[model samples]
Each structure stands twice: as structure tokens, then as C-alpha cells.
Target: MSTVKIEKGQAFWLADPQEHDFPAAYDYLELLFVPEECKAFVDKLRGATTIKKKSKDILRASALPLLPDTNCHVKENLRKIKKKEKLSPILLVRANGKLIIADGYHRLCASYYFTEDLDVPCRLV
Candidate 1:
């Protein structure tokens, strides 16, 4: 996965701005008509909804910066992370008002690859 570094006081969703195109490659895996196994998996997702989450409220591309010092090649693992990218839109839940990464770690990394940023879309619940 793309290296990630969290900084203080920055709530941003680094994303693949390319997603603005709505690429077919990004659709196949998340399509509702996919295989039975896939459908079952989708069904298990938390808080599935048709409502469009506010994009403005979410973080944008360009938060994460390049890795420091080491130049290790972790591309293969990163590719795998991208393939499993979720469409259900990971939720950052709060039990008593603490932010958490409920899901979408891969998407977070993928966002970094597409944009040198490490921020990612998040929903507070």
C-alpha cells in the first residue's frame, strides 16, 4: 500500500481525482449485478445506502506526502489494495466522539498513489 503519514489537525480525504471520470474499470467490481459471492459480500457491508454522501464534507486529494528516506518497492501489495477498494464508502464511527478508520484503508492508500496526498473520504457516524 502507498505509504501513509498522519499529521495533526488535518481532516482530508485524499482521492483518485480520476474517479471524477467514473471509470468503467472502477465499476465492475462494485456493480450490483456481480456474482453471487460478491453480492453476498456486499450485503455484509455496514450502513449501505443510496443517499449521496456530501463530497464537500469529505476530505480531498493532496494530504499525504511521499515517503521519507527509504525507497522500498511495495507496488504489488498496493495493487492488491486497489483491487479490494470498497464502494460502500467506509464510515468513521464514533462511540463517544473519537474518530476511527472503520474501513477503506486501501482506498486511502490508492488515493495516495493517484495523488501524492494521504487524506481520504470519511463519514462521521
Candidate 2:
């Protein structure tokens, strides 16, 4: 994919998620839900429209810790940002008043490095 030109510390994102993102999300969701439930959530996420939210807010809602800059995955995402490569929109599941990051946790954490107020694009179900 062609890289996007970022300006003023803004991160770039693909207009829609990559095809592999769905299966990756399903694989992760399976850990928290039955296969049937995972399938349903993936289906819903596939049809969900992209929305923007602050990276810090998502972390707060999900109650997930921000991975450190030393993490391998987070480092990779940071490299992508430095290279001006577009990142895939994150996939999320909102249940029981919490947000589950089905995919793109590393990306979110990496984006937080730029700014906690950074607006992240995501598909939420």
C-alpha cells in the first residue's frame, strides 16, 4: 500500500480495514467469547462504519494498560509511523460497559506515543 504523508504529528490510517484484520480480530475475540459469538461480533465489525475516538479515552474505556515503547509490537507500529505508512483502523467490541480491542492494540499504544489526544479511527461493534 502507498504510504500517507503525515503532517504536524498526525497519524495516517487506511480508509477501511485490511481483509486480514477481520480474521485476526476473530482469533483474538475467540479468547473471550464462544466461536458463535466471535463470528457474530466479527460480522458486526465488518459492517460497522469507522469512527474516531481519542486514544486515551479508548484505553480508559477498555481498562487496558498502555504497552511500553520497548514492546516489540508497539515498536513495529512506531516504525510504521516514522515511515509514514498508513495504519489499519482498529477493531473493537463494546460489551458490559467496556471496550474490547479485538485487534490493533499495539497500533493504539504506538499512536499514544505521539499524543494521548490523538484521534484514532476504529470499527466498533
Best by TM-score: 2
Candidates in order have lDDT scores of 0.36, 0.89
lDDT of 2 by residue, 60-118 (tens): 99999999888999888888988888899999999777799999999999888888888
lDDT of 1 by residue, 1-125 (tens): 33434344444433322233222222332443345633343333333332223332233322223332233333442444445433333443333343333344344444455444333444444
In each prediction, how many residue pairs overlap at the backbone (N, C-alpha, C within less than 3 A)?
Answer: 9, 0
TM-score of 2: 0.92
Candidate 1, residue 104: the lDDT equals 45
Report the poorest 10 consecutive residues by lDDT, candidate 2: 1-10
Q: Which stretches of candidate 2 lie over 4 Å from their true place?
A: 1-6, 9-11
Candidate 1 Cα misplacement greater than 4 A, ranges: 1-45, 48-77, 80-88, 116-123
